[model samples]
Target: MAEEKESAEAMISEIHKQITDAFDVFDHEFNKTVDVREVGTIIRSLSCCPSEGELHDLLAEIEEEEPTGYIRFEKFLPTMTKVLMERRYRPIPEDVLLQAFEVLDQEKKGHLEPEELTKYMSEEGEPFTQEEMEEMLSAAVDPDKNVILYKDYVGMMTVEDN
Candidate 1:
């Protein structure tokens, strides 16, 4: 509801702030003409995005927009937009993930039993399939405890953007 909306807004705002700060840093470091290699370096330093293997692809994509061999801050804006739109590159907010976890962990025992999580996600909300729930649990939950720790869930869902 309102809380979810607020959390989403806060996450978007934080991402925007991070991108703006990166722009400022780039402007100060490179005098308005950044190359593909520089873009890779800067982005790698800024966030865990555009993995090393994806750098070439990112450069190619950016070149389509800028056409020029170098990218100024103005040109960089579109690249940032593209990066933000990419789920693999985008960073979800920990607070938002925690809020969702809280919704699932009604008892607030600091961990969610697999059944509780699976039932909620597969029946109460948007309804993920049984397979999807199993996959998610296998990847993020503790097999021994048969539960998911909030910290582990947060780590799996989001990355440190700063």
Candidate 2:
């Protein structure tokens, strides 16, 4: 039992060490902070990589965006903690998807009409391009209902494009 505990501790320690190394490398000014570009690069290089759009979603989730888009280490910790805690990576959480959906679902219908979704994507913070929004809509929306269900939206966000 003690041996098992020791092994787990070792694994955690190793992971922490790797994170510290990356943090130091990306903190170019040694100020314990990094810009959006550095965060993007580090995230892209990580094991369970995110798509560019997903990276934007992550940045939003972290809520670390300053006027200059500089993210301090503390502000970025929650995202790192969650990612590290997951045994196997999954895409964005259902609750996060729901929150995002709610922002655009002005009617409180629990789903987004195509136009409403388009408007939201274009008008919301870190606005999506028309092409990107169209691509997401085509991939996630139900043709019959002409709306995006929460499950479908979560599934779309969670899918890791190869």
Q: Each model's C-alpha lDDT?
A: 0.70, 0.71
Write model 2 residue lDDT over 69-162, tens digit each, in one string. Answer: 7777776665775676573344465677677777766678877778877877789677888788888889778988988886666765664433
Worst 10 residues of 2 by lDDT: 85-94
What is the TM-score of candidate 2? 0.47
Q: Candidate 1, residues 90-131: lDDT per residue as tens digits?
A: 445889888888877778798988778777787774687777
TM-score for each of the candidates: 0.44, 0.47
Off by over 4 Å in 2: 65-68, 87-162
Structure candidate 1, residue pairs in collision: none
**Using TM-score as the measure, which candidate wins?**
2
Candidate 2: the clashing residue pairs are: none
Can you give the lDDT of residue 53 in candidate 1?
55
Error of 2 at 162 (Å): 18
